[model samples]
Target: MPENDRLRNIRKETLSSAWYTLYRYDFEYRRSDGRWESRQREVYDRGNGAAVLLYDASRRKVLLTRQFRMPTFVNHNPDGLLTEVCAGLLDGADPEAAIRKEILEETGYRVEQLEKILEAYSSPGAVTEILHYYLAAYHPGQKEAEGGGVPEETEDIELLEFGFEEILEKVRNGEIRDAKTLILIQYAALFGPLRPVAREIQ
Candidate 1:
């Protein structure tokens, strides 16, 4: 390894486990002004994951999910139930493959084609997670199974389908607060295939 390029004396200690792993990290950093500083921070790592925004252009509708998140609950969220896009941890699988399985379990939509939007860090400050964003076209005919999430995983997920335009309104009004979900909604509004068309006066 190169000597004293930027970071050095790296160390980590495990904090917790279960669905994800938490670690406390310590290292010495070389600042821009050629100064060395020691720093430490705790990071939560559940591994990278994938998410999708499913929409039906014909009906102008979108599919999302609602579920109780323990973290949200403990952090002062009233009910802890969040409305979000279908998503799941990669769990040692490819991003696209993982998302396909996740969507199947969360929304019952058989995704044949998915447009990868981008990859993002959920919270780089303290989370070692990269979220792969995606968008897919879906219709009622594509439903394969009842998508309430995997029962064995103890996921009590609820399927939610709403008007394409109406959901964005909820986002603006502070109803939908999930970061990934909000990103997908704003992306769909600006660049999705189901955008509304404005007609010129005849």
Candidate 2:
């Protein structure tokens, strides 16, 4: 341990089965200084891994999915249909590989190039999920399947493509409501225009 390092204490932890699609867990910890703490952490507990939010640069648009989320249903919406970028948990795969796989699985959109934008924790205070956001470019003929998502996973998904104005409208109309999606969209709005050109002919 380093001299400047701080000590953290955990007093208790409990995990429930991942009913539906969400991981359920409870935790309590106490610090070395005698302070006590408690929290509920979500994730497989095998490990915390990477996720990605994919963006399309040339279209000046983003691809998102509308799927039912259990947590959202519990909180407010029984419908719980959420609009989110192509994303998936990285069990052990590299972030880029995970993004590519998820893109294929979720949207059936193939990419020729992919670039990393940022890596961040989904929520530091409780959960142990991290996201590696990415941007990629795809051509018109690349979209393949209906891409409704996996059925064994119980996913009922609708693929959607949104222009900048459309997403801004969604945001203004309170349609785009997920936190991670909000963050990624805002990041794109402020910085998307700066993305490098795919075709630079000499």
Give the winner by TM-score.
1
Candidate 1 shows a clash count of: 0
Worst 10 residues of 1 by lDDT: 193-202
The CA lDDT of each predicted structure is: 0.87, 0.66
Query: Clashes in model 2: which pairs?
Result: 9-29, 9-30, 10-29, 10-30, 11-28, 11-29, 11-30, 12-28, 14-26
lDDT (tens digit, per residue) of candidate 2 on 27-79: 44556886656655554443333334455556766678889898899999868
TM-score of every model? 0.92, 0.74
**lDDT digits (tens) for residues 1-202 of candidate 1:** 3446899998889899975899998899999999999999999988999999998888878899999998899998999999999999999999999999999988777878999999999999989899999999999889999889888999999988888667866876899989999888878777775445201111
lDDT of 1: 0.87
Cα error, candidate 2, residue 13 (Å): 4.9
lDDT of 2 at 197: 23
Task: Give the top-scoring candidate (lDDT).
Answer: 1
Task: Indicate the residue-level lDDT of 37 in model 1.
Answer: 96
